[model samples]
Target: MKTAALSVSSEECFQPGLIPRSPRLLETLLANLDGMVYRCRADAQRTMEFVSEGCLPLTGHLPEALLLNQQLSFEQLIHEDDRELVRWHIGECLRQRRRFDVECRIVCADGSVRWVWDRGVAIYNATGEVEAVEGFMQDVTERKEAAQALQEAERRYRSIFENAIEGVFQTTPDGTYIAVNPALARIYGYRSPEDLIVSLRDIRHQLYVESERRSEFMRLMEQHGSVSNFESRVYRRDGDIIWISENARAVHDDAGTLMFYEGTVEAITERKLYEAEIRHQATHDALTGLPNRNMLHDHLQRAIQARQKGSMTVVAFVDLDQFKYINDSLGHQVGDELLKTVAQRLLSCLRDTDMVARQGGDEFVLVLQNQSGEAGIAEVMQRILAAVARPWPVGEREFHITSSIGVSRYPEDGKDVETLLKKADSAMYKAKEQGRNNFQFFAPWMDTQVSNRLDMLISLRRALDQEEFRLFYQPKLSLSNGRIIGAEALIRWQSPEQSMVAPDRFIPFAEEAGLIVPIGEWVLRTACRQNRAWQDAGLLAIPVAVNISPRQMNQSLIDFVANVLRDSGLAASWLELEITENVVMKDAEKTVATLHALKSLGLKISVDDFGTGYSSLSYLRRFPVDALKIDKSFVRDIARDADSAAIVKAVISLAHILNLRVIAEGVEDEQQHDFLRENGCDEVQGYYFGKPMSVEDFTLRLRDEAIRGAAGK
Candidate 1:
């Protein structure tokens, strides 16, 4: 480690003689320099020959300690790791007779590492031999550390951009892509980030499905400088539309100049589609795919609003006639199909401006908008009636059904949606009361009728609890024997307020309200008990028939009848069950089964008003019935009208051929009685025999008739 001695002073190294300057001024200049000025020998030890005053601050060592290698050699101050590279660089420069410059690490006297820049030249002697190297060295650690920190930050930013799941992007304000990550490319349906950036040059036209969305985005950005959860529909690279949500901010430089827009994008197409489906299900009926009641209310309100502008809007409530009978008899499956068919027919019958909505279970509400007057509405209503009446095939059979439509016009019928619907419903019930299969315009009178019906329904419920109903008996005379054989048990509602409520007054409503099931059961039990009581009192034991509605037939009628007969101790033969032809023809198969069941229980089953319904003769043969009652309409004119008389004769002949008895109803006069008696009619029951009377009156009449008969015999 032997080193050369210093042979040069600081003044000599700075060449004051060549510059022609004072030593004091030169010393002051060197002292003020940012780094140490030095001369070193061309040796491995690099012995220092001259050192400036700055050497104390730069190297944390005194100039005397550095000069002449008094305490430490300059080569020893060089960092071990950078010493060889520095030597090689300086050596090559000296050989080429040029100045040398390099940056390397150095160890300060305090043992802290410093980055240093060194610049020097080989000073030559007169014979071209190397004397020493002159140089200046300065600390550059701060600049080097700053550059390293920047490089590390850039690496971290690149990692985040590549790995993020949400799309990250930077775009110029002019809509050109500045930078985009892989996630952004995937969201836009591109193969790669480069492809997306290259292809999507115009974001407004190429990205947004609606051009206005882009404008909106820019407006929001300008106003608030950022947008969060901004949703919009945009086109993917493949021309498919998708929903996207963006959270973006306008990036700016330190001087507040706009640099670019940076944002994140999320694909939300699946979520949007799911939300739409849920909305549709909420507003649509599941069975018929029609607008449901909720949607109908909204639609009707809108229609009323439209009508307020001097135009009429008709709200029609359509109820399918006999739909419940068909539904209960066949099954709910057929009912649903029938409703769908009705909905389709209703739609076909109306203009495109109209709407048909399902108000649940065989009920539809129609909105006819912007009508001219009654004529226009009437025509549409008629069309609806005709359309609904058309025969439709269900399963293996072609079924015919009808609609009862009630129409309430906006402005004329109350002002609001509920009022219009209420009035329309009331009018619809009137159509049912007027014998169904028709349409009725809402009249103010219908409101009172609706209220009365409502009151009656309330009373009917109370009547059941309070025993407000009474059974009246009408005698049936045997036309062959000229003797009373049996009686028909008819129900009478003796209201506390009204004297009597006829069967026709509340029967239809009770059926519609589903109260008939309970009421029918009550009637059966009471009629059976009364018949057994008459037998117990030593009156002639005769069969008493109780009318059965279609609704009652669909229930457990056979079981109910058996229970009644058991509880009343009346033989089933003494309690006949009467069913209308329409009820039997509704579902012939089910009716046949019910009839057989009753017959098995020894109850007489008669088809009442037989000629009124369209019953197939083939199926009629299959019904296990004891008798067929000629409809009152036919019997009312049987004596005078040849057609009625001929029909009655044919029915009696047919009944005899089938080995069944025939009863002619509504026989009001001697001519009618003689006509039925001469025509082989087995039984007769009507006002002619006697009007339906209370139990006590009928019992007294029976006693008087028995006395008179005994005397006549």
Candidate 2:
């Protein structure tokens, strides 16, 4: 490593102290040399002639130990495995008369191996036979390790790119595939990455289903420098369409020059199909495969938004008349088939712009858009009436079905979905009232009727909670003795705002609103307790008859009635149930079973409003009843109308023959009373005996009767 004894090539590298000023500079430069400078003989031992001070640190040995093989030859410093390689390389370089450059590992004094770069040229005698060699060697372990690590990283990246599940790609900004991994090729239905890159000369035109899709992707990349979850439809190599989502970023060089777009793609066709199916199931009816109520609302709202000034959006609420009969007689399966058939017919009656949705069983809502006027709507309505009315054959029978349609026009009848549907429903009911197989246009006046009914229903719900309901007792008199036999319980509502809400005004509404059951139970409970109260007051006990609505006549009625009597401490014999004839006749078998069950409890059962319904003589014979109350319609006219008199007389005769008592109601005057008494009616309830009165007034009447009886005795 000593430069002083070497033949100097550079002018500044001279022997130490040869020039007084340059010697110090030369010594300083040699002392700071990065590696060991040495001279060795071209021999098997490679004996070192001179070595620099850096040899101690570079080879873990002093220059004196290595020079002239005083301790160990420089050849021994070479790793055992690299000794032959070093010798052969140096010999070849010398024979070629060139500088030798090689990288070899050397064993250090501490047993640690170090990578070294040995670079030097050989100097020879005047005959050109190599005489000696000079070289510089530096530790290169860090650089070697770094190069090895780079090789491993490249290998791992290639593996991932080849086998990744998601497609990996790099494409030019102008839409040509520059590089693609195996996964990308597979996703695009290509044989290999090379094939994919070669085939997709124009990525946008060949891959994207929409020609403008690539333009949008480029625009997004330019705006944001990245794109995430960019979903689009694209064609595969086989020309089949598939959905794909891409996550990508624009790649750039260090100078911020645009390079290419690199991204990952995920095939999502199956996910897209699954989501679409879920949406379809949500918006469509399972039974009829038509749009359901939710879809109807959505469609109607859209129609309302799209409705223009010169045109109309018509909403038609259609109801199949008496469809329950079909479901009750046949099965739900047949009913479902019929509904589907009706849906098709309804669809056929409208333009393509119109939508028909199943609101529910036997009911459909139609939204017709862009209609010119009532004439067009009317024409469509007529078509629906005829189409739905056509005979539908089920199994062996051909059944005729009809629909009642209610029409509401946008901006005229309503401007919102709820309002439009409600008005349409109101008109539909009006259509049914006018008679089925027809359609009705919604008028402003219809809202009045609908609102009143709705208000009355709302009030009825609060009536029980507010204690606004009262029970009035109308005395039933025995014609033979003219004494109170029993009193019928009637409900009356006293409203602070409307004075009095009559039974006829709210009872029917209460029935439709499912409020009748609770109201009916209250009446029964109150009447039973009142009859027991009269007996406690020392008055004669008589059965207190409370009317039973059809809705109240469920399987639980017997238990409810028994519980009421038990709670009131009233004997079963002291309560009578008066169900309307129509309720009893509606389902004869069920009515018979219920009536007999009540009769078994020792309470009297009677058909109220008799001679008013279609009661088969045979069914009447089996009814478990103690009496029949003649309807007021016949009784009111008995004195003036012969048909009414004959009908009344016939009902009494029939009751007598069946061993049942006959009571006539609405007998207001002498003639009506005379006719009933002469016809052998057992009891009468009318203004003649007494009108329905408050609890206190009725108690007074009962007390007076007891007083009169005592005086007579």
Q: What TM-score would each prediction reach against the true structure?
A: 0.63, 0.60
Q: In model 1, which runs have C-alpha deviations exceeding 4 angstroms?
A: 1-208, 213-278, 286-288, 305-354, 358-413, 424-446, 592-597, 616-622, 640-659, 670-679, 701-713
Q: Per-residue error at 708 for model 1, in Å?
A: 7.2
List lDDT for all candidates, in order.
0.87, 0.88
Please give the TM-score that candidate 1 achieves against the real structure: 0.63
Which 10 consecutive residues of model 1 have the lowest summed lDDT? 1-10
RMSD of 2: 9.9
Model 2, TM vs. native: 0.60
lDDT of 1 by residue, 39-151 (tens): 88898888887787778888888888877778888778889999899989999999999999999988888999899889989989999988889999988889888888898
Candidate 2's C-alpha runs over 4 A off are: 1-138, 221-225, 252-259, 270-312, 323-341, 358-363, 370-376, 389-401, 410-422, 470-508, 511-713
How many clashing residue pairs, candidate 2? 2
| Residue 570 lDDT, candidate 2, scale 0-100 | 97
Residue 264 shift from truth in candidate 1, angstroms: 8.9
